[model samples]
Structure formats: structure tokens, C-alpha cells
Target: MVLLTLWLTWAAASADTTKFDVQPFKINLGSEIPRLHALVNNTRLPSKALYGVGQDKGIELDFLAELRREWLEVFDWEAQEAELNRFTQYTAEIEGLTVHFVHEKSADPDAIPLILLHGWPGSFQEFAPIIKPLTTPTENVSFTVVVPSLPGFVFSSPPPRANWTVDDTARIFNVLMTEVLGYKTYALHGTDWGSVVGYSMYGSFNTTVRAAHFVFLPFFGPTPEEIAADNITLSDVEKVAENKGNLFVSLGLAYRDEQTQKPNDIGLALYDNPVGQLAWIGSKMKLWSDPRAGTPPSVLNTTAILTSVSLYALTSSFLTSVWIYASNPNGFSTTYSQAPTDAPMLFSQFEYNIIFYPEEYVKQTTKNLVSYKVHDFGGHFPGLDNPPALIEDIREIAAVFVR
Candidate 1:
């Protein structure tokens, strides 16, 4: 009887080792880097714009040229890869798909488990700067950080079937934290499309997703008329944010529409073309980042931009990464419904996020609103635009809710 029980234990462990092997990962583009350089060298950009050239005209011709030169001559993918690999990373089969993630466990036994998600045009690299800070022991608190490459992005496998949604990804991640990593309850922070998936987990997996923090949400806040009717006055900063949002709707939605309507076209066109990928992805990275980047606290710079473009180009996942837009037409247009969770929720609003959710409208979506901080800088990508503030905000949330 004792032999039978021992055999059963060995068999279970063996199955787990074979089927759900979580192995260390290293970023090795190998020959892809040289090929990428060749592509950049051979590329022919449009003759510098003759007239009427500006931000409204789309990515500046001169800027694209600069990026092309940097890609061929200055950008070092190997160095960037080494920097990224400094964190503990691994790949495991989750939900029958290969999932790549950075799992940095804190030394503190009671540290909070926190998952950070990234969105389109961004990869797991979005949270790279904050991983060490979050996991290191601090006077306030620390986190056992889990940063995953969203399905169809970077190292992760693309969705195996059509119509895969953020909620599906959320379920896989929940299983990863609870069953795979053995964390019964975890906290999460998300931005851009990450917020969409994080919201799903916060609302649906409330039993395990104990607390949450977000820089963006999937739903639209109250319309201007609704705000006026409710007598909700907008602050000067908020008014500026509202104007920027209106600009985004009018001028910035072309990429969204193309990705939504013709995912295959853009995907295939830029599949093997590294320069094209740089222009397409770099434009957004440049435009959406804090305008004051390169200054203190905002780390968005040339190397960061090139590294992002390289990740998409070298992974060969550029084509599949845009699948999120096409898969869910209403992904970002979700009506403001109450997030069905009593877990404490916190938000950090950045000045240049393209949209603003007034505190009143934000409160309407959740029962437990613990914190809402407004920063004077930072754009859509807070981790890149304002890493210090972003790090501080996460620490604050963990101290209050996760500790």
C-alpha cells in the first residue's frame, strides 16, 4: 500500500514535469538581427516631404529616416536582449499554448503576488523597468511580479482559433497564477489593452484577484452632456485631457480602424519588413509617449523605442500581435457597467493618456474605490513615460490593499 502511494506521487510529478514544464527562457534572435539590418539598409523611404509636413500628416519623414539609420547603425538588439534577460523569465504551456513570462519572486514570504499586463504596440517589455523595483524589498512593501507576453505578442503563441478575446486570456492567466504558480490570491496592474483583460479578471475572478490597480479601463466614461447634466465640473487639467481625447478620436483612430478591418493586410505587409515595422510601430511609440521624454523620470528614448520595434520584428509575432483589434470590435467601446467585484480598486491617471475618466464616472464602475491619483506627466504608456511615478503608484496600492 505504501509502495502504491509512492508510485502515484512519482507518476504525478513526472506528468507535470513532462507536460507542464516551466523552463527558463532567453531572447535569442540569432540570424534574425542580421537580416533585420539588411532590410533596414535596403529600404527606400519616401522622398523627404516637399511641403505641408507635420504631426497631422502622420509620422514625420525625417523622423522615420532617423529611425532607419539608427536601426542599421546604432541600435543594438543583443545588448537590449541581455538587459531584458536580467530578470527571471520562463515559458510554460498554459491553456495548450506556449506562454512566456517574467516571474520575479520577492524574498519576503508575505509579499503580494502582482501580475502586470501590456497592450498592443507594447510587449512584456513595457513593465521591464519596474520588475526589479517591485520585487526588491522596500520599507513600504514588495511584489512577486508576474509579467506575461499577451497571447499573439512577443514570445507567447498566437491565439489558436478565431474570435479569441481578452476574457479568454484572462482565464488562462488566472489559471497560471492560481494553479500553475500556486498563488491563491493575487493583485494586478494593467494599461491599454491590459486594462481590458485585467478588468475581466477583476470582475470575474474576484475570488482570486483580491485587489487591482489600473491606468486605463475598457469602458468609456460619461459623455460631456452627461457630465453637464450631472453638474460634474471638469478641472483645468481634465479639460485639457478631454481636448486631447477628442483629437485622438478624430486623428488617431486610423490605425485602430485598419487593424480592425484589415488585420491581414497590415500584418503581411510588415511581416518581413523590419523598417516598415519600425515606422508603423515607432510612430505610435513616439507620438503616444510623454512629450517631455528624455527629461528626468521619463525614460522613453531612442534605445527604448528601437528595442520595442525590434521585439515585434524579431519575434515574428508582429502579424499575430494585431489580432486583438480584429477579434473584438467592441473591446474598447464597452458600456460603463459596474465592475462586478467588491475588491479594492485603484487608478493612476496620467496627463497625456488621450482620454480622461472623471472621478465620479470612475466611481460609478466599482463599489470599492480606494485610490485615484492624478499625475502631471505621462501618456498612454506610463511605465515608459513616467517610470518613477508608475512605480510609486504600484507600491502605494500594494501597501494599502495587498499588504
Candidate 2:
């Protein structure tokens, strides 16, 4: 009886350990692409805006209509899928959920291990522009880039419980890096909701998450009184950035309320509706991006926009992805303790990101801030808006913080 029990215990242990094994994945949304085309073909766009085709009123009807034309007549999913597959992709079961990620290892024997995180309406694809450059830099520095889809975002499974928070997602990501991949330490860069998780990881897994770079933060910026108390100086450019930020807070966050209060409504409404998804996500792709995105050097083109929506629609993850807002009510208005903690932190402040947190305010959140970069260009999605600039900022951070 003792011998039989020992054999059964070993078998059970083997099965449990194998469950978290990473498996190769490719973005083959084959038949789903056809269904998407049909949905776009049949979608009826809303009537032109009363104010005409302009962003001041919502997504311009003319712009969205052109996008619709492009989606049905010009966009190519297989081409985009091929581009995404150029790098290695994989999925692993972690904490009872299947996690999808892009893992690109550098040839450099001493390459730094790094994980890139994405936020709402964005996926692992957001880091596509920087993945190859980071993993295979011309200079001596290189990284093993690991970009994971946030829970319920693209190919990753949704949060198993409605009460799930970014803190929970942070815990699983730590497992991805330290436990599954067997990395003693790693670094991270995040934007949008990714920054929220990145902050959590930096605080909770400091021994393993050695450093972080963020383009956005979950904390509110300093108020006028706080700025006066600090006697901080602001440049003319900083003044303009602050004004734009005010415009965003005053006029731009109604979507936040809807998503946080009634995620199910918008999620279900746009879940299978390709055009609806396009209009919803495509508008933000343009609005939140730099005004100069269509010019040379910018990667925020119509095809990129379409590919983002395709990832959400093809995977049928729109509903689950929006649950993030409802799951964490205090996401944006977090009150950090004055006491700074965690590994050295780095920041990249883009000119057009909706909110502007001055270096003074950012420093309050962490004790060991190593760098803060201010860019004249780029917006919320800096990886797409300005890849070279973002890459440089990250590399500089790694040189200082990563061993």
C-alpha cells in the first residue's frame, strides 16, 4: 500500500507541474477573419455627425467611413498576422488562467530579461515596434522581451472572477517571469493599464522585478495648491501640456464612467459588431494618438488601427477586456503613500498623453527614481507613436537599473 501511494503522489505532482508548461502559438484567426469581413460588410454606419466630420464632435463620420472602406476593401488580416508571427509567441497556464505572450530572446549571453505590459484597448501587439529592436540592438545592450496580454485583453483568458484587480494580474505576471521562466530577476516597461500592473509588480515583487519604466501612471497629478506649496517651476511647454490635460479631464473621460459603471452594456453592444468595434476603438486610436501621426515616421496608420480591432473582434474578448474598468473602481484616482518604495523607477512623459504628471509629482510615488524623459512628440501609445524615442528611453533605463 505504501509503494502504490508513493507512485500515485509522484504522478499527481508531474501532472500539476506540467499544467504551467509554455506552448508555441501563432496568430491564426483563420475562419474568424471571414466572419469579421461579413460583419463589416453588413454594418450600417450612423448618420453623419450634426457638426460634420470632425473630432471635436466624436469620431468624424467621414474618417470612420473611410476606415470602414479600408476595413472591407483594403485591410489585410493575413498580412498583419504574418507580421505578428515574425516573432515567437506562446501561451501558458498560470494561476488557473491561460496567459498569451510574445517572448523574444536576445542572442546576447548577458541580455537583460524584460517584460512589456499592455493596457485596455491595447494588446501585446502594442510593443511590436520595439520588440525586435530591444531584443537585437546594434549596440551591446539587448533584452529578452516578454510582452503579455493583460487578463481578458487579446488572446489571454479573462479574469475568472468579477472582483479581480490589477494587483491579481501583477501576481500572475511575477509567476510568469520568476517561476515559469526561471529568471532570478527582470525589468518591465508599461503603458496604459500595463503601467498599473507594472506599479503593482514593482512594489510587490521588488526582489524579482528589479526596475520599471512607465509612460502612464494610475495616480492623479498634483493640484494647483500642491504645485504652489512645492514652489515648482513650469516651462511654457509644460503649461500647454497641463492645459491639454485639463481639456481631457473635463471633456474626455465620459467613456471611463460608462465602462466602469456599465461594462456589460458597451461590451455586449460591441462584442460581435466589427464596425462598432472599429468605430469604438479606431476613434481612440486617432484621438489619443499624436496629431502628427499620419506624417512620416509615425506607425499609427489605418492598417495598424484595423489590426488592433481585429485582435479584439476575432478573439471575442471585447466584453471581458472592458471588465477591467468595472473590476477596479479606484484605478485612476489612487492615493500613494508619501513613503516611496520599490526598485528604481523610470518615466517617459509624452507630450500628447491625456494627463501630464510633472517630475516632481512622479518622484513622490517612488524613492529611487533614476530617470524622467520628456518627449516633444508621441501620445498615449508611444510605442506606436514614437518607437525610436521610447526605445532609447527604455535602453537608457536598463543601462542604469538592470544588472
| Per-prediction TM-score | 0.93, 0.92
Per-residue lDDT tens digits for candidate 1, residues 127-231, read 888899999878858888999999999999998886999999999999777766767788999898999999999999999898899988897655677778998
Angstrom error of the Cα, residue 108, model 1: value is 1.1
CA deviation > 4 Å runs, candidate 1:
1-19
How large is the C-alpha RMSD of every model relative to the true structure?
4.5, 6.2
TM-score, cand. 1 vs. native: 0.93
Worst 10 residues of 2 by lDDT: 8-17
Clashing pairs in 1: none
Model 2 misplaced regions, further than 4 Å: 1-19, 224-229, 338-342
What overall lDDT, based on C-alpha atoms, would model 1 receive against the true structure? Answer: 0.84
